[model samples]
Structure formats: structure tokens, C-alpha cells
Target: MKENVFYGKGMGPVKKDYPDIYEAIVGLNDAVYTGKALDYKTQKLIALAIAASNSDDRAVKKQISSVVETFDTSKDEIMDVLRIVLLTSGMPPFVKAVNLLYEVID
Candidate 1:
């Protein structure tokens, strides 16, 4: 399985040192990201929104950077999601998401 860009540093050793567990996690990720009700892009957006809403800086950056790197998501599109973060998650999370967005775009 290819490494997921979003996996945290805590997971690095798990992938290298625990091959079976890493395979299991990769399978689970495929199950979740395979898109059922929503299409792939929409699901990714939802994931990004959730990450931003949680105010997890690394998660937010990883999600945004992964989308930009692995898919065709645009800056305007990401900013739109961050706008929703502003309304639903409040200023701190929204600002942090926006900051990460800029860094990713650059």
C-alpha cells in the first residue's frame, strides 16, 4: 500500500515496524475513502472540513496539501471550505485552516 500523506508521524514507525497493522489500516482507509453516498471529491472536502473544524493543525495541513498534491482541488475551492470553517468552527480554527491553505498553495 502506498503511504497516505495524512498519516501522522506517530504512524511512521507503525508502517515501517508493523507491516500487518499498516496493511490493515490501509485497507480501512480504502474502505472509507472509496466513496459510497458522496463522490470522491465531495468526500475529500468533507474530510477536509472535519479536519479544519477539529482545529488540528497537522491534520488540516496534511488534508489540504494532500488534496492539492494528489487531486485537482483549487485554491478558490479550498478557500470556500475554509469559509464554511469560519461559520461553523469559529475564528481560531478558520484562521488556522486559511493559514495552512496559503502555505500549501505556495
Candidate 2:
């Protein structure tokens, strides 16, 4: 599995390195289960939008790639999510996210 960006390496060891915290978070998975309500395609789109809004390039690109691989979602659909993020999250962060997305997708 890929390491989490927040707790991995240069970010320093926090809850990720602690077995108790990790287990606690893992146990809390039931609190926010995504299930099959939106389907993989829609879930990826929502994830992309949220990542973009939050200015998380790694997460945005990761979700974009996952959507491409799993649901065969196109670049246009990913861009649409970015557009929505721009509307909700403002220009600067969205620009950075879009640049990162282009870097990965292109």
C-alpha cells in the first residue's frame, strides 16, 4: 500500500507510526463508510473535488489516476471536478491543484 502523505517520512511520525493511533483510526472506519451509494466513478469525482478544494495535489492526482484505472473516467470528467472545486474553494488553490493534475495527467 502507498504511504499516507500526512504521516509519512518528511512529514514526521505521528499517529501513523503509533500502533494505537493507527488501530484507532482503522477501527473508526465504520463511522465513515463510503459503501456503494455513489459507485466508484462518482466517489472518485467527489474525492477529486475535495482534494482540489483542500489544495492537496497528491490526493487529487491519486484519485484522478484511480478513477482512470478503475472506472475509465476521462480527463474531462476530472477537469470538471476541478472546475467545481475552483467555484467552491477559490482560484489560487484550485490553480495549484489543476497544475498538479496536469502534471500528472499530461
Question: Best candidate, TM-score-wise?
Answer: 1
The global C-alpha lDDT for each of the candidates, from Candidate 1 onward, is: 0.83, 0.68
Model 1 lDDT per residue over 18-81, tens place: 9899888878888887766877777778889999999988888888877776676999999899
**Residue lDDT tens for model 2, 36-57:** 5755467558867887888876
Error of 2 at 42 (Å): 1.3
Q: List the residue pairs that clash in candidate 1.
A: none
Show how many residue pairs clash in every candidate, following the order shown. Answer: 0, 0
Segments of candidate 1 deviating more than 4 angstroms: 1-6
TM-score for all models, in order of appearance? 0.84, 0.68
Residue 73 deviation, candidate 1, in Å?
1.3
